[model samples]
Target: MNATPTEMMTIAAARLLTNQDVCFVGIGAPSAACNLARLTHAPKITLIYESGTLSTRPSVLPLSIGDGELCDTALTTVAVPEMFRYWLQGGRITIGFLGGAQIDRFANLNTTVVGPYDAPKVRLPGGGGAPEIASNCGEIFITMAMGTRAFVDRLPFITSFGHGKGKGDRAALGLKTKGPTKVMTDLCVLEPDPQTAELTVVSLHPGVTREQVQAACGWPLRFAADVAETPPATEQELAVLRDLHARTRQAHGVAA
Candidate 1:
């Protein structure tokens, strides 16, 4: 059988991160992608966590930023405040790995509330350190499963942050960081427009169609006029990615 969508997403994210200068990673998809990069390429990258761990080398994806495994494998865990202030806020982190409860075309994220701010739909896990990471990290790499529910036209609340307000806002704000550098989804890879930072599908998987991608997104999605086909995962890439997931599931006690 071919790789699953989740596996494809991880591989796309991993390839993008393989050459990042530095990464401020969150848990889950980002963790898997970051570790994949470490195991393959970009060994010199400095991986920092919001929990104050730096240069961690975990054999599996972390359950959360504060998981003890992070501390154990870290080069050295430092004071939390110092981590945010001295490193993150100081703009030392070159890339940030982000996931979201909801996202928009601009790659803005919301993890605070699902429906009305006052009351309504589900209330997701509060943005623990996401707000800080979203704004502080030099650049961001968003990883999320593609579905109408998750990639909304607009988020109910602004939980974290966006690339300024819209288009040229990030540049106008004099932000040196690249904002969101890339977005990896199950069916395609998206990139922000050079001028507007609006997300456009740059590449699509072999069997995925533009109509299907748009159908799956919550909002009216945009596609590049000339989108390219994504390169299929090489045997080596697939093997490494599969091995990583197997190891992660085993560690987390996922039922065999």
Candidate 2:
């Protein structure tokens, strides 16, 4: 009857995609949310991967971007270079779904080195194609677990670009694609400021307080004066999401 935090986040993210959009889906939360969209409202939405697979429909969560299921179930598989050159860089792909190690107020992400680029605190798996995804995709949506460490006022490094020079700067940079359109976190949904595009809490999930959301965020996070409450996920949404995760773990040999 109630929505798990993940399911609520997925529903919130799913609503952003549409049948007319071509989406570049990241692994984990982004994958789950994108698939939810395909199964629910945006059945015709085309899903793309960095590995050059398009329109992928896996019954289970993929272990990684390199998983064979993506290519196997894809509508077509292009060469890695071709995929970016034509589909992404060519300005055909409409949406990019991504997750990162660190996010800042400007919504820029850090996926390269953890603390410093050279002498890092914790070196993470470098951005696979996230930079290009952010740069070339028509638009993007980011999904990540919200914790004080992951959400900060300034990223440890700028691994993947969002609103690098702040909002409105993207237009001045002569970029074709817009910056991150939204971010879906466990306790809330955030959108960039209209001018600066700095991220601020726009809505709080049901039963979540502004203080709780702020405590979880790393930075001195700001909240809208009139933030709205997030609607809990419906029965149908929970069933689908739970089943999907169950099958994902069972098929991948990953314990849930």
Q: After the best TM-score superposition of candidate 1, give how far the Cα of residue 62 lies from its true spot, in angstroms.
A: 1.6
The best candidate in terms of lDDT: 2
**How well does candidate 1 match the true structure in TM-score terms?**
0.93
TM-score of each: 0.93, 0.95
Summarize candidate 1's per-residue lDDT along 66-140 as a digit string, tens digits: 778889989999999999899999988888899887888888898889889789589788888888787788778
> Total clashing residue pairs per candidate?
0, 1
lDDT of 2: 0.85
Clashing pairs in 2: 167-196
Inter-residue clash pairs, candidate 1: none
lDDT minimum window of 10 residues, candidate 2: 164-173
Candidate 2 lDDT, tens digit per residue, 142-229? Answer: 9987898889777778888898868677788788688797999988999987766878788888898988988888777777678998
What lDDT score belongs to each candidate, Candidate 1 first? Answer: 0.83, 0.85
